[model samples]
Target: MTDKSEYKDSFRCGYVAVLGRPNVGKSTLMNHILGQKVSITSRKPQTTRHRVLGIYTDDDAQILFVDTPGIHRKEARSINRYMNRAASSSMADVDVLLFVVDGTQWTDDDELVLEKLSHAKGKKVLFVNKVDKLADKEEVLPHIAHITEQCDFDAVFPGSALRGHNLDELTKTLKQWLPEGDLFYPEDYITDRSERFMAAELIREKLMRSLGEEIPYSSTVEIEQFKFNDKGILTISGLILVERSGQKAIIIGKGGQRLKQIGRDARIEMEELFDSKVFLELWVKVKDGWADDERALKSLGYDDYR
Candidate 1:
């Protein structure tokens, strides 16, 4: 941990909330900026269901990047409401609000995020992500122009989060907006989340990637056991909770092949992230209406922001 007094007088440190609708690459942008995988991401919408902090420290500034859940109009379930609350809450008490949008297209969800951001106070930055997907380079300017027309932004940059394009310039510009202050987190700390929470997220990411559209959203991961054994290997046991038995059956697959593959994939990533020998065990359990039940959602670690 780096002490606040140890930093120079000119050092700048503050929170930057990364706000956007689901599947807009908010997590991907934060991960690339920190040069590490602190936030889990997938093609599925609302992959990030919590307000994850990714701390970045450099010689000049320390940026506490708050990677939040994508704000959408759908508040269909308890989990959805929880995610929206988590994201909306992050808007307060941040030094900057980095609004990310898919440059290829825009939707009502983007407008919803912008409307929510309108009430928040901060240095607002518009990030037009996925510009690389655009067939013509000229299309970028018009798209950026259209978005900026709706709301006044302090700064706007068009870049590709996946390819790490224009992010360096964006970071430099963001540093200018932050006031000089002490580091919020230690210099070496990359995230505020615990290793146990990260393990559960990794398992959930595998579930999202492996399963079909509906199951991933209905499922959640709970870390039952996490500890270093006497053999110097980290052993983890995770329970996958779903709303229905049919969803559990689909995840378990024929002879449990699907579950085994998901666990294997998660374990491999855990080994790389934890930098240790990992022994991961996974089990599927049906918890009826867990996603909609407020008590169940809270027990599953969904109410931290609330």
Candidate 2:
């Protein structure tokens, strides 16, 4: 163990909430920064439903990156409301707020996120993600300029989360903004979430990736069983909840092949993450209108933001 007394005076540590609209690469940025996948990601919007912590620690600083759900205009369902709340509440009590936007293209949802960012108390930083996708490189400067005019930011950076562009500079800038303090987590700890929570998220990521657009949004995962056997084979049983029987059928697919593939993909990732052999079981259950049901949402672990 390293002695805390050596670096106590100069060590920097704080929470940095990564805020953005859906599909802007906020989760991807944090995952890349931490050099691991603490938060799950997919092309689908609203792929991240919870506020996941990605801890990055070096010799000088420990950056607690809070990967939040994207703030969007949609609040029709209880889940949507929960996601918005999760994103908004994360801004509170954080040392820095990293507001990410897509390259050169801003939407109504981005405006909504900016509006939310305006009221936040933390030192705000703007990140223009996916800049590599831009056709004309000159467009980056003017686009960032336009956004900075709308609201004040401590710093701005244009980078591609997928391509690992300018991320080292971003990390260095974030460290400067954090307050000097003792470490919030152990040096080896990469995230604040438990293995069980990560298991549920890993399963959910596979669900989102495997199914079509509609089914992914209408579903959530619950870990029914998680344990280790005598020979150290970890066993996990996941119950996937969907809104209707028809959707459930689609996920399970013809001859249970789709569900089997989802289980296989999830188990492989789980094994790599847990560093042990895994026995995975999956079942789909129809939980009608759970997404819109407030009580059901609360029971399904969506009430953490409150």
Model 2: weakest 10-residue lDDT segment is 1-10
The list of candidate 2 runs beyond 4 A from truth reads 6-8
Each candidate: what lDDT? 0.92, 0.92
All candidates: TM-score: 0.97, 0.98
lDDT of 2 at 60: 80
Global Cα lDDT for candidate 1: 0.92
Candidate 1, pairs of clashing residues: none
Q: 117, model 2: CA deviation in Å?
A: 1.4
Candidate 1 lDDT by residue in tens digits, 129-224: 998898898988888888788788999998999999999999999998889988877799999999999999999999999989999998999999
- Model 1 misses residue 110 by how many Å? 0.5
Q: Please give, for residues 1-306, the per-residue lDDT of candidate 2 as tens digits.
A: 456676657889999999999989999999999999999999999999999889999978999999999899979888999999999999899999999999999999999889888887978999998888889989999888888888899999999999899999999999998998888888889998999899999999999998887999999999989999999999999999999999999999999999999999999999999999999999999999999998998888898885
